[model samples]
Target chain A: MLIDDNDIDLKINGKIVAFTKTFEDIVVCRSGEEALNYLKQHLTTPERLPEFILLDIQMPEMSGFEFLDHYKKLPVSFTEGCNIAMLSSTLDFSDIQRAEANPYVVKLLKKPLIPAVLQEVVKEHLQR
Target chain B: MDTPSVKVLYIDDEEHNLQAFKASFRRQYEIYTATSAAAGLLILQNIDINVIIADQKMPETTGVQFFKSIKDTYPDPVRILLTGYTDIEALADAINHGDVYRYITKPWSDLELHNSIKNAYDAYKAKIDLRNKVSELEKTNDELNRFIYSISHELRAPLVSVIGIVNLVKMEGLYNSSGEYWNLIEICSNKLDFYIQKTLQYYKNNKNVAEHSPVEFEILVSELISLYSYSDRDTQFNVKINQPVGFYNDAFRIEVILGNLINNAIKYQKSTEPNKFVNIDIDVDVQRAEITISDNGIGILNDHLEKIFNQFFKSKNHHGSGLGLFIVKEALTRINGKIEVTSDLAIGTTFKITIPNGKAT
Candidate 1:
């Protein structure tokens, strides 16, 4: 499932609408705080958990980094096998280093996210 | 011509010549008439005299001796010797040893006196003007150096942040299910690329006067739009190009200009809206080439429009470092280009850029 803060453009949204044929569900959140809250509230049943989250680093309340900080202390069952990829428009080296250092972070992807990047990620991590 | 105000000191023991000298030029000049050498030395201590004319024949001292005494202490004031035929040899000695400006015979003409003083004043003015110019140039050089240093620091800091994030992704063996983390990394990288390009363009434009070349409009616009179109399934943006026939253009500079404008449109668009649209129009003639890029997004406020082109100036909108427009303006200036903008908040903004076809006359 794909998750992003921005309202996906009509063209990309259309693509997502088309791609959903292959996926069972998708989740979206505006901030890392909201994402973490949603995961915690839903983890009790564990059936509604998403396999992937398309995370954005810059947000209003809690950033992606803060979300990861809080996510680390939560029970492992909450995360399970879910992957979190950080997406940003910042080319800052320190941000890149911070994302790389975080264990929960899967990869640091630059915008705008094209199909090639998505395919590469799926091939490297989810191909089984 | 009006006689210049010369500060003359007569040191002759004979009171008659001292009175005669005062009577000769008192009305025409601001004469600082001193009777003795010691009194002349005292006057020099309080006032700024431009020329010091002294009598060669004195009771206790010669004009050469008095001139020698003040040479090092009051170096700027031009020194001259006034002497009778009998004191001609001593006058020569003063002129050679003390570097006196001129030697005048007794009963010197008022016109001759005025001419000498005027020449000395001109010399003094020239020296002061030269010194001021040098000091001003030094200040400008220091400021330019400081500007280059700060630009380097700002660029490097962001680059370091991007590299650090990239390293973490590679070394930590961490895996994420969400694509958000990767998006952040991409944003950082793109920003770095923009800054590096800007720095290079600035350096190149400043270093050479003749290196700018005509730009290709249609090709550059196509390339920029394709680069920003990141999502395969995202809203598609249509870029349009219309140039007047028979117009030749400078392709390189136009690329840099359009690159910045289009980048901002993509970067600062309203986030809540799903139907994001960016439009570009280009028209060129022999005299100038005009381009307009408009986007359906959140627009800039009135207060920020004035400072939008200033270095490192960013609007309250949280998308860019504010260097994009600044760099665009700089690049445009090198080619004698002009840019103007009109926008409505929350609706859209349009940028109109005109590039002169040939070098500015």
Candidate 2:
């Protein structure tokens, strides 16, 4: 799943991820709230939940960090196996540290989801 | 220029002296007479008095004692002490310490009294003006920091998106027709990103308070080397580090220092020389870390060496934002570190840096 407010980023990142052909499907959420809603709606359908979440930190309404706060409150079954990777262009060290310190976050990748990073993600976390 | 009347408060227990002072200065100034130190404190609470003149031989409180008492509360008002020759010794110390701005002797000349009030008020006004300017400067500095952070974020977001699109095009092999254009775009974007990062680094070095953490030189130098490897340069890095004991310093600033120097070493490498190399030697102990970064590159001119640490100072073959070395110097200052550079125009340049361990409490 890819979450970001920018449409251009979403389109570009989505296509890049698809080109890798690592995942079966790519879910796009325009905002953190929409992602939360999608997660809540498919709470009972465990298989429908996203296996990996590529979250953008900066967004309108609910930020990626705020989304993580809400996501943590959801039932463990809904979030148990999912990996939250913070995908951002933030240069602030505090923000980077915050993202890294989050329990649910598996990694913080700099923006423009290149194939090499996706492959590393697959090898490191997804393979297990 | 016609100056406004200086508001003067004369605090004295002697009713006659207060009356004489008011009578003498009434025409030239706004005279406010307080019979005792208590009355002067009351007047100060209610009014904005620019200068306060107090007599030393008061039954309740001496003038120097009154000035000292109101130092924190009525700090804006410049204090003038009136004393006899006998009390000069005590008042001299107060004057030196700046608790009292000036001291006037008893049986004072009208000229001396008038001059003291005028000059003291000027000092008071100058202090206030300087304080206002300092606060304004601080406000502007804070706003600039906020602006830098937000602007960088806004600038980088779309840039990375463009980079993403560029990467996608390259992945699809669509750049074969316009490879040069793509390369140019990539170069420009990378330069823009580099400048943005440098600006943020400068800001961070200025704004952040120095922090102390265990520093591993091998890890830090290697990380910086890898960070600069993305640049399309084939400069060989030969790093040597000896850390016999755990070194403690600001990790962020250490990285900034190493990052900029390492980046410069790679960026300024001799393009024609097939065997371009950078040698980073680090020696660390419990007390300090001494680092030397040398490169076989086009070196800085003797004249340019002194000015290189200056903000926005670029050399002839400048490719950086000109903030790299300046930020390095500033970060060093924060951590109480020192740097020295030696270069021969075409042979190479070497920078020696020494950073002391943060105080262990």
Candidate 3:
């Protein structure tokens, strides 16, 4: 699941993910609210939830951190199985620290998600 | 805003003593007389008196006791004690407990009294000014820290986009319309250019002085409105320039101020209102120009008015880039100009800009 408010960012990242062939399927969400709704829809079957989640910080209604605060409350299986990645353009150290502290979050990637970095993430963290 | 005249409050048990103090300082200062400590407290509470003088000998309470009583409630006013002969001990107590700044003897000379009041007000103001300076420094330091993060992010986003597009070119070898890829690069380049230009504009306004030149207000303003307006043509605009004498001002500074305001007027436009409009009137004379920009859009809340000019202060309703007003204010200050804003919630906002206009010599 990819979450970002910017359309261009979403497109570039989607293209990179497609080019890398990192996953069998991809779920794209424009905002944190939509991402939350997607997770809720797949609540019963944790397998339906995207394995790797790419989230952006500065969204309209609900920010990426706000999403984390809400997402952690879900069933343990859903939270534990998904490895969330923070893909943001923020240079704030506090934001980086908070993302690092979250247990569900595995990586903090600076956007716009070029193919080389995507290939590396798939090889290292997402590899079975 | 600093008041033109110093407000002095004199308190004494004897009405004659209060009259004497007021008579001496009335020409130089705005003097307020209170016959007793109780009366003086009332005046202090009601008025922003800069300095307060008290007589040591009184029926109900001495000057030291009175000063001590009001020290907590009215700490800003500079306190002075007037003591008679052999009241040196009371002066000591006033100094230690009451926080009295200066002591005037009962038979004080006119020159001595005049100098004391002037010095007391100056000392009081200096202390307050220092405190204000410290807090302002701290605020700017904080904003600079936040700005570094924001600027880095803004700069990095575009560079990363270009980097990602380059990776696509490497893998796929090119798209059917390579122009599409080139367009993305151009967009990123323009975004970066805007950030660079705005940041430079902020520094230039702050550090460097601008040259005065003949400004064709009508043409310059119309060009600005066109540049900022969206291509969709949603918001209607009305511009009126009454410039019989072609205005002379710092064109760069004016551009910065007008550009930011015009951009905001368009960006935070009312979505529900069909006939959304922006009205601008520029009236220029030989020495000054007053421009008013009004918009029927989502107005700022009354609380955020004071802070809108502050760096990185964005309204809760409108999540703007947050640098626009800061730059506008900076440029205005450079050109010795001022801006005033009034807004009605859900109705609209209006900004009044006042800048000096002189012939290019």
Cα displacement (angstroms), candidate 1, residue B247, comes to: 4.9
The TM-score each candidate achieves on chain A is: 0.82, 0.94, 0.90
Q: How does residue B218 of candidate 1 score in lDDT?
A: 75
lDDT of 2 by residue, B102-150 (tens): 8788889999988888899889999999999999999999999989878
lDDT of 3 by residue, B166-224 (tens): 65665676744666866577556556645655665665566446778888878888888
**Error of model 1, residue A83, in angstroms:** 40
lDDT tens per residue, model 1, A54-102: 7767655777787778888878876657777777655455688899788
Among incorrect, acceptable, medium and high, the docking class of model 1 is incorrect
A1-128 per-residue lDDT for model 3 (tens digits): 88998887887888888887768888999998898898999898766788888898878899998999989988887776678888876544457888988887877887656577767876777757
Q: Per-prediction DockQ scores?
A: 0.02, 0.84, 0.31
Superposed model 1: Cα runs more than 4 Å off: A1-128, B1-207, B210-212, B230-235, B244-251, B359-361
Q: Of the candidates shown, which would achieve the greatest TM-score relative to the real structure? A: 2
**Best-to-worst ranking by lDDT:** 2, 3, 1
Q: What is the lDDT, from 0 to 100, of the residue A4 in candidate 3?
A: 90
Best of the two (1, 2) by TM-score = 2
Docking class of 3: acceptable
